[model samples]
Target chain A: MEKKSTEQLEAICSQVRRDILRMVHACQSGHPGASLGCTEFFVALYFDQMTNNPDFNLDGPGEDLFFLSNGHISPVWYSVLARSGYFETSELKTFRKLNSRLQGHPATEEGLPGIRIASGSLGQGLSVGIGAAFAKKINKDDKTVYVLMGDGEQQEGQIWEAALSAPHHKLDNLIATIDLNGQQIDGPTKDIINLGDLKAKWEAFGWEVIVTEHGNDMSGVVKGLEKAKSLLGKGKPVLNLLHTDMGYGVDFMVGTHKWHGVAPNDEQLENALGQLKETLGDY
Target chain B: MENKLDTKYTYTEKKDTRSGFGDGLLEAGRRNENVVALCADLIGSLKMGAFQKEFPERFFQMGISEANMIGAAAGLTIGGKIPFTGTFANFSTGRVYDQIRQSVAYSEKNVKICASHAGLTLGEDGATHQILEDIGMMKMLPNMTVINPCDYNQTKAATIAIAEHEGPVYLRFGRPKWPIFTPENQEFEIGKAWKMIEGTDVTIFATGHLVWEAVEAEAILRAEGISVELINIHTIKPLDTEAILKSVAKTGCAVSAEEHQFNGGLNDSIAQTLIRNQPAPLEFIGVDDSFGESGKPEELLEKYGLNAKNIVEAAKRAISRK
Candidate 1:
């Protein structure tokens, strides 16, 4: 229940990055690039930004809720949820193992404490967020809904469909963040499919667009999320474009799509862990 | 036996099953505060206007985004909201298959996917709008319950019934006006077969619009002294195996009828059930692995071999095989 400072949050982010690397390396499966990239944002939300209960109620009434649309980055989310006391941190070892609650993608079937729905399919979280936002409004709970999606996921037609309806329905209680890492599994997002003028696209879709240059920076994410939260009830859904690195903290894996899904080898994991401080003991 | 098999039941007026869904949804909203509705730009078509008007705050107009509507419906379930998504059968199942599969079915969210304009009975809208494979697609999902109610009364009861039940459900109804033979305000029991007539000759298991055809086929076969046992198998997934096996055991022959493809419709479920339990001589009356063209509802039914005559012929063929 102790409030975390910006420096404390950064240390947690580093530990989350380590958790992501170790979890993926242990499974020999999972997408680590975005998971590491969104570590700061996840830490900021769970530890600092989101007003949530660690007890983990499925409906999340009277509290801020978050959804992972680009569910491939579930390692980072699972790490943060466990670190934030949603469940025991020791459960991180079971990530992607048989009968593990932490699947490759976030799912609720295992009765995971934090996940509200199964998500790995792209472009679905925003819609689910909008629904939760609407539900909050109906229940007279003034809580906000946060969703994280991949830049590559914007190509999915359903994302645009959700984009058009969120603002139309005046879902100001909803705030969506896109990890603009500029890299996807195939290659660079521009080469795969350029998302020209993301800010313009969101503006045209009637959302209040906030473009942040430093998504990997803990202070920047905390600031951007605070600003997005401040803009609530303004009759516009907020869209935050967080510019981040694909393989953020790991030196060898950074700045490329090569590590988008591949797990780090034993030596590579040791090197990655060396860069990411184990401020909070490793799971 | 309680509902009098020998007495013939008929309706003076005909109504589309979709209207029953609309009425049932409105009633459900009235009954439960948690019942909510979502539509993918097909409110009028899905007969959801009444629900929308009555409960505008709870009703979500999701535009033409069937995929988003489905995911949102799944999300709504997290808050104990029983969301009923409305759209055409094609958009409901085929268009958003992965969305429903991942977000709703796999997540085990309590969602009701109310699909209208199902099967060839969708009339002149043609094959693109008329979804004949939705029942199969939905039934295959692990946590999905598939229901294809025959008439307005049955569809209404089924709609209201699904709202009370937990987990995901696919309620498939048609756009065309059909006979309303089932009782009004009847309690619809999920996965239970409705036996309209009991006979010794053959068991005619039908669903959706084809149930009416089976009724007519029963009347014709009864005149010819065939003595048919006409059973309405509304819930396709939890196939009333006991009812099917019991009826087929008594008759020694079966005819499965539906307004869907013969490959993966009610017939396929009945076949799987019979193959496992009481193996009986079976014939299928459905679209013979072909897409339907633009035509009247009645014409399309006749052309696709989903009429009373087709059921009668299938019954005779099954009896002969037996």
Candidate 2:
């Protein structure tokens, strides 16, 4: 809907990646792989697609709402929300620490402006998105609702239950995006639990499914999101399957599942940061 | 003692707690503009047909997805709207345990998880549907308010009461057309026990459909020259500690009954309450750790030791201990 230069967006995303590393390293605990993999998507979604007025505070009266189903990737979401004016970027230091608003999982209890509910346990964001979409429709608002889920998290039966019902209820205003990284906690996705034909599975559930080759590719992300927006209000929900690299910018962390929840120690951190250019100022 | 808590209250022949929840939800929709209902495939079983038919726009038939239903309920609470999600007790708690733990309970959303067909009374469906551990599962959550009402009127009242209260709550009831003994207009209050009869020898704490059997046991005991105090422990999480301690102080012994396993039903709560506050000699009336099977409701009730005779026997034993 709104176009910001790719250079600026890319700069912002690089800062987000730094924040993700710092946030995790500071806490000495947290998920950084998926956060690094999905940083560009969050940056694109927050800076480009969503119309959330963090400055306005519509009382959630008539604002766009986003739910993070895969809440373990809180580092990227917290960074993006802060950089987008939801809060100060300095708040990134408090992530996953005691008495911090940024918890390991996203929750509304901290009175955070962007997060509507607590989510870390997976396979629940779509239903929460559907409920918020229904509320928005009931309140006569044209704003849309969005949610992000992990590809492996689709194994949760509740996600499909919500998937089948969203189209049945014709929640066309809701759009769900999946980070299809093809890896989970144990090993490769197939080794852990093969999710056969995810695109066909969603299509079978009667959703308008879209696919992107690179989740971090800004131009592709913008194009895919724009196409998803055009399909809205067509009497069906939208699903975007973004094919993302496991560690996106970091060469070593890419294409593996071992780094899913582990925080990089001092040596690994230096190696990872070496591969990723500090294009933007570090947190 | 025979005239204890006269049953002159007018109620329909008998009705499942699901119907009461449905009725209460319809009333809530009419009373509050922000009340919305979401169902996960078991709409017909949950008695949400009336709500869907009346408010097609407001009722969201969420197919067979319990995960999304929980998340959506949390999202609906973002702007001060109250969302009620309905489904079987098994799927409502066990199937989507993490969803509820994170999205709804930990987040502290004002969503009502209305679970029907709890305990062994979910007959014919057998062990898969009979979820006795749901009380313990839901109560363990930090911000969740666990309530298991006795019958149709009480369940309906609880449904209405939860919509008014602003927080996450789990309202548990059952399938069978239980004896609707409570007054029609009884105002349901959370964390308060309903004293059906006054006695000083022993106290009987009951919840859900077992409340009827407990009352019957009280009548049977009265006939056999025993004065038994009957207390309906509808809300389990907020266990009515004051009422339980006060009753146990006078009657230094207690009996707990429910249509669930002895592990995590009303008995465990009563035991914990007494252990924490006032220690009392207690007897438990429930099924042991065993799975249910396909059978008639009354036949299963008798076989599982959840009938009036079990409560009466437990009361006699409790009195002996005192």
Q: What is the interface RMSD of each candidate, in Å?
A: 0.9, 1.9
Q: Provide the TM-score for each candidate, comma-separated.
A: 0.98, 0.92
**For model 2 chain A, the run of ten residues with the poorest summed lDDT:** A54-63
The candidates' DockQ values read 0.82, 0.63
lDDT of 1 by residue, B26-118 (tens): 999999999999998888899999999999999999888898898889878867899999999999999999999999899899999999999
Candidate 2 CAPRI grade: medium
Tell me the spans in candidate 1 whose CA falls farther than 4 Å from its real position. B1-7
Worst 10 residues of 1 chain B by lDDT: B1-10
Candidate 1, after superposition: displacement of residue B191 in Å?
0.8
- List, residue by residue over A1-283, the lDDT tens digit for candidate 2: 3578988788888778878887888888998889989987898889987887877352377767788889999999998888888888888899888999998888777688787777887778888888888888888888889889998898887788788888887889999999999989887888778998989999999999999887889889888988999999999999999999877777777778867888888887887777666765665
Identify the candidate with maximal DockQ.
Answer: 1
Best by TM-score: 1
